[model samples]
Target: MISSVLVANRGEIARRVFRTARRMGIATVAVYSEADADAPHVAEADQAVLIGPAAARESYLVADKIIAAARATGAEAIHPGYGFLSENAAFAEAVIAAGLVWIGPPPAAILAMGLKDAAKALMIEAGVPVTPGYLGEDQSLARLQAEADAIGYPVLIKAVAGGGGKGMRKVDAAAGFAEALASCQREAAASFGDDKVLIEKYVTRPRHIEVQIFGDAHGEVVHLFERDCSLQRRHQKVIEEAPAPGMSAEARAAVTSAAVKAAKAVNYRGAGTVEFIADASEGLRPDRIWFMEMNTRLQVEHPVTEAVTGVDLVEWQFRVASGEPLPLRQDEITLNGHALEARLYAENPAGGFLPSIGVLEHFRMPAGIRVDSAVEEGDEVSPHYDPMIAKLIAHAPTREGASDRLAQACAEVEVWPVKTNAGFLARCLDHADFIAGDVDTGFIGARLDALAATPEPSDEALMVAAAAALGDQDGPATPWRDLTGFRLNAAPETTLRLYLDGRPVLASLPQGDVEADVLITGDEVIVFEAGEAYAFSARAPIADLDEAAGDGQIRSPMPGKVVAVSVSVGDTVTRGQVLMTLEAMKMEHGLTAPFDGEVEALLVSAGDQVSEGVSLARLKAAA
Candidate 1:
């Protein structure tokens, strides 16, 4: 039996595992990078170790450092959380070699399903339905192109060694195949250290569905059911739900049985997920679904499965790692209710959903909601990691009820400074199409314009901000509060001007002069209106003079490392020429030329870390 454990990862997952460990009376150890020395998970652990610097490779990805930290802390087991080295066959083997229990599937199981090509072949031989793809031995560029052409247009270039939507791209036609392949390969190498790729036929109107499966050394493999991860942006899941909506009993049975078959074929152990893609053009059907790949670790959306099945998957991981029998037999497991999860990310949905980074000045989840988060109000959201702030989950007797509850909870979110997708998520939850369960992978992309449309504050909300600015509410009065339309023997109406998301808006006291239900905290105001909350920033002092952005100037949109400076001074460029690539929040953002121009100054270089609004280059307009 394992008495102590060290989580070999960081962020929310670490915190989550620590919670269960504490409840089980097991001592917990946390390993952090330089960037996370003061992180919540580190503080929560009974013992903390600083392994390396901020970059994951220098810290979390270094297997020796992680194992050494575990040994130093006298940890009896190592739990590799999702991402990082969780699915790394070598890392798992090394952990076992160190005489410490590995709280996951065996190393051979990881290798068997590590690569998409190899895993697909294994699944096919196991009599499981597999997607038609080109996973050949020849990784030559010409060979890949030939296979992609045969697979037909609208194909996907995917990295064989990685998951989490990284190193994957969709090619709509033959003309863009080469560029997409090269980009996918570059990302694959940087992320997973394997540039080998596989080509697959992209399912039209796809719905991403995955079955949660578990196994033990006793050869028992049971599934916890399925999750619909169809709501996605750029192949990354934005929202997920358990007991997928509109799923027939036949379809669920087919997917879950297939997932179990795949697991038994590999003699899988512990918690793992078998992912599949279904052609949802006419909704879910048994034969329309095909295998995608298997994730050989705990998934980010495990909570929803737990909510519906009343199973604590992490606890089972601990039990299985200690050589315990399966928690319950396959025939005993049953689904309970419906559950849904929405990921609150630190990003600007309006700004093309670019991941945001900085201090979370006013972070607060809605009261009475299940929130799994690792950051507090004053925590810094560094650019060295994923920008997800938290996962908000809701459980109810029905799917619509769960969706409604989550939507209301998202609307209750109050965050500032570091923008969040809270409002955007709220819109998605209540959208008519989403309510009717008419969802596919392309649902969000197709309705992005309407979903991302900025919400307008009500009249009462505007008055709240105005009243707070004037100090006319239940607070200490400022000297300026008494100066509103001051006139001797004369009555006059006064108005206040404020900026709502950078747009000027006029506000005045209501007819009753009653304060709205709002919370004024210094310069930030949280206005509660119609059961929804709207956060507004105080207008900055107007500048007497402002400089306009010239077409030739290119500035960094977010703070990050300059991964690539593609242009030099005097280089001729076109309207959309990529001058440099800035990597932030683990995604690359391109700084391109505004128009046809010549590079006049290259102010930044590769490897330099820059802040948002930093001038990276200046281009001179062509004569």
Candidate 2:
């Protein structure tokens, strides 16, 4: 058995690995950068080492620093948790070369499945079904365009080295192919340093279902089952669940068996996920499913698989890394119940899902559920890393029951100041199509406007906020009674002025206590409803409010670099015209004109880093 383990990652990834290490009675080592010096994972580890500065290039991605930390701490092995150096074949090889066990698959297997184009060819040879596509060596734009025409319209151009939805584009027709190809290649080079791409037929209605397969050094491979990660936005998964909702017995058998075969083809060891894209224009069928790519590490959604199978995947990884034989035969793994996992990110769904960065002044997750979190109350959500603060998982005897529980859990979340996607996740889980298992990768995008719109505070919430802003009542007397003056029950109908999200509103309370959880932080009164936070402060209505409007000031929504400037000063633009594009938190956001106006000033240029609320451009109202 491995005596000590060092996790070469940060945030919840490291924390999760440390948890299992402790339970197994093995010592845990944590390596952190300066930005994560006070992180929970660092404090919980048996030994900690500082690797580098805040930038990931200088810290987590530096394999030499990680190896040195492992040696200095007398660590027996290194576990590359999900991201950063987790899938880096060179880093895995380096760990082995330094006389420390590498708790992952062999370097050769990683390279075999690292590129999507090459992996598909290998899977085909292994008798696993793969999606029809063009994976030739030609890098010419004309060649890619020709391939798309042959593949038919609505082709998906994906980076051969891409994952996590980056470096991919969908072209609906021949006219859009060239521009989409350029954008795809640019993103591919920037993200992966590999500009090569492959074109495939894009299923109009695609469901992302992946099989979790595990292997041992003895060449035994078994699958745990399948997970539906179809609920996504912009190619990124938001919610995931196991045993796919509408998967037939035959479909499940086929997908899981193919996954095991793919693993065997690479002589794979430890945890790996074989992702398959299902054409769901009709429904999930064995013939409609095809292999897309393979993730050569433990997936973030592995908890749902564990919940259904009653198996500890981390423990299995440890056993396999120690050169042990398979822990369980193919028949030993049984799917029992249903489980759902929602990523709780520090982001504002209403504000175009922009990443929210701030100190978590008030953070609370619902009780009686599995929560893997990185930050606690008072911890800052820095802009230097992924904005996902935690993952909320729920399990029940049935799929419907699991969905209901997970929705309730999202609604009960209470985080403030720093926004989160809890409300959006709750809405998604409660959506009618989602409940009926009629979902696909385009589900969120199709209904983004509805799901991202911030709901108005309910009357009950308004009353609660009003009462809290009024302060304590005199000796058990209802706060509503005091607001209407000390008059003797004269049909108390006094309206008070309050600001909700900086907008003034007239509020009145009923005679009794409002049934809602309220948090009073400083002068701000916050109320949580359906997983949404409404902050209110009592104050006089602002005069000349229109002066602030129609100013034509385009401010940066969050801290990021200005990737492109599409308009110049004195240019006339219509409302909603994209003026510039800002790259933040690994996503591009287009800043648009709020109204039809002429550009009066361009305050910033391309490549300039801007902070949140900084005015990047301004316009003059059209005469």
Q: Which candidate is the best by lDDT?
A: 2
lDDT of 1 by residue, 1-623 (tens): 68999999988999999999998989999999999998899999999999999999999999999999999999999999999999999999999999999999999999999999999999989999988989998988899989989999889999999798888999998888887887788778878999999999998789999999999989899999999999998788899999999899999999999999999999999999999999999889999999999999999999999999999999999999999998899888898889999998988887777887877656668777689997987788888888888999999999999999999999878665677888889999999999999999999999999887666787767866676665544565333122322222221345878776556788774545553445555554566542234555456645434124465667788888887787789999999888888878878777788889899999988889998888889998888
Superposed by TM-score, candidate 2 places the C-alpha of residue 59 at a distance from the truth, in angstroms, of 1.0
| Predicted candidate 2 versus true structure: per-residue lDDT over 429-543, tens digit per residue | 9999999989999999999999988889888778777766665423332311222221122224457788986688988865654455677655566788888999887754465
TM-scores vs. true structure, each candidate: 0.92, 0.94
Task: Please give me the total number of clashing residue pairs in predicted model 2.
Answer: 0
lDDT of 1 at 169: 92
Off by over 4 Å in 2: 472-494, 541-549, 568-572, 621-623
lDDT of 2 at 144: 88
Tell me, by TM-score, which candidate is best. 2
Evaluate residue 188 in candidate 2 and report its C-alpha lDDT on the 0 to 100 scale.
77
